[model samples]
Target: MLLVDCSNCRRALELPPGAHSIRCAICHAVTRIADSRSLQPPPPQGFYSSTHQHQPYYPPPPPPFTAPSPYNHAPRGPPPAVHGRKRAVICGISYRNSRHELKGCINDAKCMKYLLVNKFNFPESAILMLNEEEADPYRHPIKSNIRMALYWLVQGCQPGDSLVFHYSGHGSQKRNYTGDEIDGYDETLCPLDFQTQGMIIDDEINETIVRPLPRGVKLHAIIDACHSGTVLDLPFLCRMDRTGRYVWEDHRPRSGVWKGTSGGEVISFSGCDDNQTSADTDALSRITSTGAMTYSFIQAIERGQATTYGAMLNAMRSTIRNTDDDLGGGGGIVTSLLTMLLTGGSGGGLRQEPQLTANEPFDVYAKPFSI
Candidate 1:
C-alpha cells in the first residue's frame, strides 16, 4: 500500500496497489495519482518531456513566525535601515512542448522588464528574469527556482526600497483546508514543473515576500494569470463600480492566518478575479501575442493614463472591454467551447476584469500610483 495525503483535506490515507485515483473520505475530493514508473529525470539537454503527471499531496511546512498579537495582528517592528534600491523578479512560464503550452507568457515577461528599465529607471542588473529562454539552469521558471527568486527579491530589504514582482503564466485553485480563503479555495501559480512538483500556494507567497517587508518599503506585484486576484493574499481588496466609487473589502483571514505585510505597503494588480480566467491572445497587441493584463498595463502606463490607481485600473479594464467588443462580444460560442475544452469544463467564456488588492485601504483615485 502507498500512503499519501488527501489533496483537499491533507488527511493521510492508504492507497491500494496500482490505484490511479482516490476519493478522500474526509473531503470527498478525488485526487489523481501519477504513474511511479514515469518519474524519471529530465533529458540530458534539459528539455522537459510532454508527459504530465500529478504528484501526491504533501502539506508544506508552516511559515515561520514570531509570537503573534492576539488575532494575528501585525507587530510593530524594529525597522531596518533605509536602503533605497529598486529590484525585481520577473517570471514567465510557458510550459513549453506540453499540451498546456502558452504562446505569449515569455513576451509578457520581456515587455514588463523593458517597461521597468525604461520607464521606471530600474537598474537592469537589479532585475532577475526566469523563463524557458534563460540559459542558466538556475534561472528556469521551475518551482524551486521561482521560490528562490522570491526570496532573493526581499532578502535584506530595508526602508525606502522599491520592489516589483511580475509573473505571467497559468494560475489555478485548490480546496482550502485552512479556512483562510473567503471562497474556500487557495490560489496557486503553476511553475514549469508543476505537474510533478506541485503548485506554489498563496499562503507560501504571502509568508515569503509579504511578511518580511519593512515599514518604508513598497512592493508592486503584477500577475497575469487565471484566478490571480489576491494571489498574494493581501489583507484588502479594492472593489469599484462604473461611477468610479470604490470600497476596500476586508479580506483578512477569519482563521487568523495574518496575510498582511510587516507594516510595509503592498499592492497587487491581477489579470482577473479569483473566479475568472485571464486571456492570452493577439487581439490586444497587433504586433505580438501577449497576456491581456500585461499588455493593457503597459499600454496604460505608456499612454500616460495611469497617473493614479483608479485611472490605471480603469484604463486596463477599458482596453480589454474594447477589445472584447471588437472581437464580437467575448468571442461568442467558439471561445466558450475552447475554454471548456482547455480547462476540463471548469471554466467559462473569455471575459475578464482586472483586479487590485492591497494591504490597506486608501483613496485609489487620489493616491499617486508608483512602482
Candidate 2:
C-alpha cells in the first residue's frame, strides 16, 4: 500500500498504486488520486489537462504562505531588505497566427518597459524582454527562453534586491497534480510554442521562483493575462471592493485560519480572478496597445503621487471602471472591472476585479509602490 496524504482533509491514507481515487476514512471526503508517488487529490473537475488551452480574447479559466508547507515543508525566513538594484523580465506573446492572437500583448511589454524605466527607475541594462516580434531567437517568448528568463530574474538575488517578472499574454488552468492548489487547478502561462513546449504550470513557477528566494529578497510579479490571479501561488491575497475596502485572503496550502508568512517578500499583481479573462485593448487611442492591467497600473501611478497599496488598488479599479465607460458601456459593477477601467476609465459595466497576493501580512498604506 502506498501511504499518501489526502488532498482535502490532510490525513494520511494507504492506497493501491493503481487506484485512481479513494474515500478518506477519516474525513470521508472523496479525493482523486493525484499521482503514484503520493495519494494527492486529483484536479477539480472540468480541466482538460495539466495545462490551459488557448481561445480568443473572450473568456478564460483559472498561493502561498510559508506558515507551513501543506505539501510538507517548514516555514520560510524573514522578509528581505528594501535596498538593492532592480532586475526585471518582461514577456509579451501575441500568438500571431494562432486563434489566440491578441491586439495589445506586444505593446503591453513595451509599455511596461517604458513605465519601469521612466516611472520606476529600472535601468535598461538590468531588464530583459521576451516579445514575439523580437528578431533574436534568444529574446523570443518561447517556453525555453521564458524558463531561462525566469532563472535569470532570480539568479544572484540578495536581500533587499528587487526582481520583477511580468507576462502579458494568454493564461490557462491545468489539473492540479501536486495538490498544491486548493481550487484543484494549476494556473499556467502559455509560451509561444506552448503547443509543443508545454505550458508552465504554477508548481514549476513556485518551485523555480518562490522556493529559491532567500529571506530579504523581493520579487514583484506583474501578470497581465487571462485567469492570472494566484499565478504565483503566494500565501495571501488582497481584495478590494468598489468602495476601496480591503480584505486579505490567506492562500497558504496549509489548512489554517491565519498562519505565519513566508520569509521572502514576494508580491503579485494579477489582471483578474482565476475564472475571469484579462483584456488586451487600445483604449488609449493610438498611444499604443496594452493589457488592461498594465495600463491601469501605469495610469494609477501616474494619476497622482505614490500612495498606499489600498489606495493604489482603488485607483486602479476606478481607472478600469472609467475606461470601460469611455469605451462603451456596462460590466464595471461586476468582477470584470480591470478591462473596463484601464480601457478608457469610463463608468459602465462590471468586470472581474484585480488581485494582489503576497506572502506575509503588510500595511496596505505603509509604503508607496516603488521598485
Clashing pairs in 1: none
**Candidate 2, superposed: residue stretches over 4 Å from native:** 1-84, 241-244, 255-262, 282-287, 325-344, 347-350
Per-residue CA lDDT of model 2 for 1-371, tens digit only, reads: 55454555444455655877766432346667663225234445554453446422322321233244322322122222222378889999988877877767777788778878876789887888898778766688888668757765765567777899989989999987655577889889999999987999876777667777778878889898778898987778887658756778767875442222236678888888888877665343323455668777777776663487777777766666555433312221122223322334555534756778887868787757766
Q: Model 2, residue 357: what's the lDDT? A: 82
How many residue-pair clashes does candidate 1 contain? 0
lDDT score, candidate 1: 0.75
RMSD, model 2, all Cα superposed? 14.5
TM-score of each: 0.72, 0.69
lDDT, residue 7, candidate 2: 59
